[model samples]
Target: MTEKLFSPYQFKSLQLQNRVVMAPMCQYSVTAKDGIPNDWHQVHYVSRAVGGTGLIIIEMTDVEPDGRITDQDLGIWSDDHIPAFAKLVDGMHAHGSKVAIQIAHAGRKAQDASQPVAPSVVTFPGEAYKEPRALTTEEVVAMVHKFAAGVRRAVQAGVDAIELHGAHGYLIHQFHSPLMNHREDVYGQELSRFGVDVIHAVKKEMPADMPLIMRISAIEYADGGYDIDHTLQVARAYQEAGVDIFHISSGGEGPSGQRKPGNYPGYQVPFARRFREELHVPVIAVGMLEDAALAQAVIGNEDADLVAIGRGMLRDPYWANHAALELGVSKEHAAIAEQYSRGY
Candidate 1:
């Protein structure tokens, strides 16, 4: 039987060596204090490439300094950041892996900002979080432009794709999640408009064939979080606004709730399947899907087009390589490095 997990797949202009994707994980190792890629970022991502991650999505990189979740997070707001990212992109490509960056704005979640901003004057529920001031209609439009600027820099840095961080109660999520957004303006009247506007603005800077991926919280696990149907409606709107693929995750809109899912392997696979079926678009499944057999089953059954390894990849930089061997697939398929081939 063909091992679908290791099979190559193409979308738009990207061709992956396998179905393994290193889901964006924050390193927070920006000791340089400028948010530029240092040796740490270079070694961190390229090691995953060497470890056989077909695609590596960098952590939530902010478009502005205040947009960062923390001052230590990566940023692409300046032209100087391009050269560092370009170097990282080159290293990943050298190892035959496509790379992407998750452009984001933390909004009220910008814990490092003296004053965080959101669509409304809501504060994230926690002692660490402070109340955020609401953005004016004019500022909302400007935020869209900030995202567009990030897109331009990422493309200039030669990334394989771009994934907007629209989930996890970030700025985009803050604009859409009714639990946080309480504006009476057009942004509030239409929940998905901010996301659509950002998508449209970002698309203007992208090449015709370059794909745009969106990471969305398909179902909120909070008490008043949006349900599957409502999330699906938002996903369809994003699809219409030119999102090429959906990376499905849940929660982060609010604190945990009665509906919060238990921590289990492949617990979020059903959400990916639902989005793929209902939206008729490709979806990437994430969350606790670290088991080789479970990930294989997800792909073999066509539950998702791609599987993102979060903690698994952290535990083993060669998680994909290990999965290839454990699944009894060929070592060549794993693209094991010549130096590491003996281990395989």
Candidate 2:
């Protein structure tokens, strides 16, 4: 029988050696604060490629400097930043791993910014968070262009795909969240408007065949947060706006209230299934899917088209290779690097 976890998976222009995905996790190692990826970023990602991840989604790369959670996060706001990203993309490709970048804006979550921006003046729930200034109607339109510009750079850098960070309480999420967006403009009237606009703008910059991925919170955990039903409506709008794949995750809009995020393995898998069944689009499941058997079941059970391992990959860079071996996959099928074959 073919082991679904280790089986090849493809969608649009993205073809992966296996179903394992290295979920985008912020390294916050950009010491230069100039938004350019440096040596730390290169070694960090390329090592994962060497470890055998099929798809390595580069960390939450912000579209603008102030859009970063901290000054240390990666950014693609300028033409000057393209080469650094291109080099990283090349290294990952050389290891036979496909690459994707999660373009985002941290919005009110930009803790280091002197003044952060969001759809409205509400502050993210934290003592460290500042009350963000609201973007004027004209500035909101300009922000869409900024997103397109960032995606254009990613394409030039040669990423196999692009994933927009519409999840978490970032700029996109802020615009879409009823808790965060108290605007009186058209953006306020339609929660998905900002995300749809950004999606359309970025799609224009991408190749017609290249798939566009959007990471979205399927449910919010904060008090008064929207439920899955609400997100389904929002996601439907996104799908129509040209999102080819959905990376299903939940929460990050604010602190958990009555409905806390689950703490068990495959907790988020059901959400992924819901997205797949309802929207009829491929979805990637993330959250605590580290165990080899469990990850395999997520695929074998047809819960998600792909599984993203965030902390597991961080703990063991060779998680994919190890999982393949544990699942009884042959070395040839596992594609373990020749240099590491003896060790396996």
Candidate 3:
């Protein structure tokens, strides 16, 4: 029987051999002290490609030095960083996996910066995160160009797609969250303005057929945070701005509250479904969806077009292969690495 999890998916000019995507997770292994991908990033991603991951989105790559959550995070601030990433992208392509890199600015969450920047001066609740200075309208405009520059570099490096990290309380989220953004300018009047501008700017640097994925926290889960309806409205704005796919995730906009999200499996599947049905767009479902059966069910039931396995992929670089085995996919469709075909 054909397994939905192992089936092919295509959108725009990007096509995946399976619905399994390796969610971007930070490695913090940049020993070079520069924002370049090193041996660790190469091995970590290539292993997933060999294991049959359909798509691998590199960790949150910052557009500026101070935009990183940690100093060790990967960056694309300059053309110098492209060659190292290009090698990894080429390797994944050789192994039958598509590659995308998530470009972002940490905003107030830049843990290592002496003073981070955000739409407002509000800092994340925890002491671990430092307070952030609000960005001037001019500065915000400048930052949009910086994000555009990052996209140009990614295209130059030949990535299959690009994802903007609009979730997890990053700079984009900060601008949209009412609790965090308290400006009186156009960005404040139009909550999605900053992100939307960034989207348009990034699009200008990309090929017409390339997919642009935006990951959004569909629910805030904190006290006084926006609800699903509110997030859906903002998502529409992003869709209008040229997002081709929505990767649904939740929380991280702020600290927990009485209305915190549940920690159960497939907790965010509903969010993904809503984006797909309501927004009329392809969606990637993530959040504790590690079980082979559950991942398959999510795609089979049409809850999401693709499933992103985070911790599961980290724990097992071959999670896709293992999932294929568990789902009883045919050997020909499994496409297990030739060197490791016997094990499968």
TM-score of each prediction:
0.98, 0.98, 0.99
How does model 3 fare in lDDT?
0.93
Overall lDDT per candidate, in order of appearance: 0.91, 0.93, 0.93
What digit string (tens of lDDT, one per residue) describes model 3 on residues 271-339? Answer: 999999999999999999999999999998999999999999999999999999989999887859999
**TM-score, model 1 to reference:** 0.98
RMSD of each: 1.0, 0.9, 0.9
Error of 3 at 333 (Å): 1.3
lDDT per residue for candidate 1 within 1-344, as digits (tens), equals: 34788988899999999999999988888584777888988888999999998899999999999898888889999988999999999999998899989999999999889999999988898887878999999999999999999999999999999999989999998888889889999999999999999999999999999989999988888887788898888878989999999999988877888897758898899999999898889889999999999999899999999999998898898888889999998766776888888888
Assess candidate 2 and give its lDDT: 0.93
Stretches of candidate 1 exceeding 4 Å from the true structure: 30-32
